[model samples]
Target: MSNHSSSTISAFGYEIIRDHILSSVLGKHENEVLYWAGKELARKFPCRTIEELVAFFVDASWGMLELIKETKDGRTFQLTNDPALMQIGYRSFRLEAGFIAEQIQQIMGYLTECYDEKREKQQLITFTVKWDVKERIQNTIPNE
Candidate 1:
């Protein structure tokens, strides 16, 4: 028999699965779980630079990722919908937040953290990622 199970799904099917996971399986824990899932996804697809990371977002259907600001210790990224983000609320973007945090942390060799700011009216999400320079040279991961 053919592998029908591996067939491509329509956008409707995609939304159905997303909604189910958000409203049923994940529910209140949706933010936390999805964030960690994003981090794990980053590990699977590590990017060496900010440009590659932004491109990865576009390729992954997460919308357009743009670097809006950069500072000594960190940067701010704005994720705006190229078309639309399906109106999934701010919590949905935590996944992207976590993904970005891990990617930057890995690139900069620092312990990083990220949080998102929602602009519901504009359908934009901003992620502020920051890391301390002191933490970079510290004993973060110990020998096992």
Candidate 2:
């Protein structure tokens, strides 16, 4: 095996690589691409319950995920962690926002959207994921 495969990267190391790619490689389109990438990831790792989705975030080392509030239309999630070694910004969480949006869209069978707000002082990020009940996802294939 290659030395790269033999060595394990720490969470911080992973964050650094992620940040570099988002900022340097993706550049201006980082947020947009990351959001789509996250949606694609959600498609791959579909969750049946909110608990499973939350657990996935922790396992992925994204941060501590918590459901702060929920309404008939949507839910809000709070993700917080120390600012040491990670870039706290809008782009940083777009992937997560998209992931949550897609997961909810699939589970609720509605058109969902997600946006995030960053509290720099608190080192906290809040994602508001919502969908209009009236805008349901149409089934493309008929049940056979």
TM-score of each: 0.81, 0.84
Checking candidate 2 for backbone clashes, the offending pairs are none
Model 1 C-alpha lDDT per residue in residues 25-58, reported as the tens digit of each score: 8888888998898888888888889999999987
* Candidate with the greatest lDDT versus the true structure: 2
Per-residue lDDT tens digits for candidate 2, residues 12-131, read 677667876557988988889889999888888887678988988876767788999999999999987556533676337888999999888887888999998888877889899989
Prediction 1 global C-alpha lDDT: 0.79
* Best of the candidates, TM-score: 2
Q: How big is the positional error of residue 8 in model 1, measured in Å on the Cα after superposition? A: 10
Off by over 4 Å in 1: 1-11, 86-91, 137-144
How much does each candidate deviate from the true structure in C-alpha RMSD?
4.4, 4.0
